[model samples]
Target chain A: MDTTSTHGASPGAARAALLVLADGRFPAGGHAHSGGAEAAVKAGRIREATDLAAFCRGRLHTSGLTSAALAAAAAAGADPLALDEAADARTPSPALRATARKLGRQLMRAARAAWPCDALDALAAARPRGAHQPVVLGVTARAAGLGPEDAAHCVAYESVGGPATAVVRLLGLDPFEATAVLARLAPELDQVARRAAEAGRRALTEGPGTLPAASAPLLDITAQAHAAWPVRLFAS
Target chain B: MHLDHSHDTTTAVSADAARPDGTRRALRIGLGGPVGSGKTATVAALCRALRDTFSIAVVTNDIYTREDAEFLLRNAVLPPERIQAVETGACPHTAIRDDISANLEAVEDLEDAVGPLDLILVESGGDNLTATFSKGLVDAQVFVIDVAGGDDIPRKGGPGVTTADLLVVNKTDLAPYVGSDLGRMARDAQDQRGELPVAFTSLTSGEGVKPVADWVRARLAAWSA
Candidate 1:
């Protein structure tokens, strides 16, 4: 029952910390971004809950899986700088890469305040511009005493959750329907998290190059187009 | 694993007094009000008035576009590099109050790009009466409302009107044309804010931003002291 001994507790006891990190309102600057939902919505690809579901499903399996794997690897103690490079390689659009790093720097700021670990500080100092959000998320999980699975789950959930929330705003879709979309995706989300965590575990020994490289070409192309728009609701 | 020591990064966390390099950071002042309330105009005027006296920069939170930042740049109040624009995803209040990460990054980037700044004005996008800047984001806040918006806005007080460090009633020149009673607004504002100060301005006239500029100068004096 000693409060000072809490750090020594098992990851099972750190469920609250995981929730804190994974919460949509973590103040890590994710609110300003639509996770490509804006671009898809503008292109008439996400007009309703069904389209949103399909879009999120596609994203979750491709870029989402890749990001989850990168996060998991970082959480499993893979080199963050290398993971950052891998994230850059996976992202074809320069615009998405900038968004990822911007979000990463913001996440680093919040994580340093929330956890205050040397590892997070080192990453922040090393990449003053930013180090890719998935990498930062993994390192943040490690700092918060969570494991690779927890980090992967966070990335996997965020992959769809961000778009679903954004579509509700852009299309004014039913909030309940949006919630249901995420509810339906929960099973796939778990699978993605498990696969990502497995890859992350392998990455701990094989290096960050071993992480998954799922890609969504349409998202990359549309992101570049979205960035050039003179007026848009989301940053990326 | 909790590390006891402070972070070694150069980025200052929120309103930290000193930069990590052991130099004093600039004092941040936030400006918030409803749309068309002259928040950007006041920011531009403040920069013009104070730029000669002190190193200054601006961080503008625009709801969707870079209009505010562009306005400042077009006026040439401060150099292009001294201005930064942050997108708020249609929630200016959230960027200024709830989730201030983007705005914080803007301020930190400004300081890094142009350091030794004496002041940085954080301007919130035109929002509702309830919007207010977080204490962590700025040392003080100014809530601006135009006489044209309605003199009754003072009586219909919200967080911005009641708790802001300073309340500015702008566009006094339009009061007669709009049929807004300046005296009533002044009295109601006094009632809403017991001892807090208020400034009435008409930026169309020469030296109209003087009152707000004086208030900022006083705040800077106290911050430097």
Candidate 2:
């Protein structure tokens, strides 16, 4: 598990390592979040597979693209602190920011243990609370011998995967249907990942401001509302 | 087979009880079992019995609410600052076993809030027999099942029944009233977990939590050794 390589290895080797990093069961605390699906379900905006697909598609281009770019930038060896600030700026909702940091801290814990990198050590010390999550994910992907494209793919998949799984729990929708929704969106996910990775590569020269600032106003508002709820299944 | 009780707060995913500076951290013990099986009661009892001798904190994983954590706080089992609740998003088992990131965060938060504590008891929300804590989250575990749930629970041995570090058959006073067979339960537990200790407790009784508390003391002693 020599994770120090910046350029990583062959495509086949990269895929195998990516599988481990992108696994849904990576123990990164993504399970407890609905990524706005819970609020959507409660608001009657998302009821079945069709609504779920639309919701995921909307998220993919908006906050999902933003997160993917941040991750890809980190994987591309961008400064995590600057990327973290970029994350905070892109995330308007204070509640979402808190959720990002909390999940960031949790992911950092798992990544530090799994990869044991010095770069993770410095970030953990600097942000004892946590940096933004996608930054950590990108940095973790880098430490795991993955590249910007790999990190982008991981973020893109997570963006929709979390909401789809959460809908299954929230609506009791068929597990097969939920999985099919993800499968249906796979092509779009790939496109988003590629664009995100490209943007990340450009950010190295153009600056962090060159990154996408796509926002979903509804999601930001709903996430804030969801945080105040006294009783809810998912955290956000 | 002496365990490395050292918990590195920085790189820990599971039960790393040593802070990065080499000083020993708290011994984390998990209590898990079926819904309504007195897991919360046993945790409260353990806190009551051990708080005098050990500086302690508690982390509770609740399915939908912080009821378990609130119970401890209401009872003053430990101070409010010493208690933390992890919302499990309706999956207690996932938080404790499959992906323990939230629980790890809660435990570490408790340690950070409180001082260099001697013990931290992590109580799982009432879950089925199949639920158990991951080794990454707790130093040791106690599977708590009430005799009232069924004496057959031990006989129908699942992972928690067969392999927990300690199996606590709680609410023994209700055994006769509920028509549960205590002797048979004891025998079945013995068969399921050979050489591992089992404690039968009625927390209402004065000395009921002593045996489990003694076991915890021994574990703490060994951890500090």
| Model 2, CA-based lDDT | 0.88
Cα deviation in Å at residue A18, candidate 2?
A: 0.8
In candidate 2, position A110 carries an lDDT of: 85
Candidate 2 chain A weakest lDDT stretch, 10 residues: A3-12
Predictions in order: lDDT:
0.90, 0.88
- Give one digit per residue, the lDDT tens place, for model 2 in A103-193: 9999988888777777787778778788999999988888877888999999999999999999999899999999999999999999999
Interface RMSD of 1: 5.0
Which segments of candidate 2 are over 4 A away from where they belong?
A: A1-13, B1-10
RMSD of 1: 3.3
Residue by residue across B1-225, what tens digits does model 2's lDDT show?
A: 112322233565466666655567789999999989888888898899889999998888887767888888889988899988887777889999989998888877777777689998999988898998999888899999998898899999999999999999999999889999999999999999999999999899757888899999999999889
Best by DockQ, which number?
1
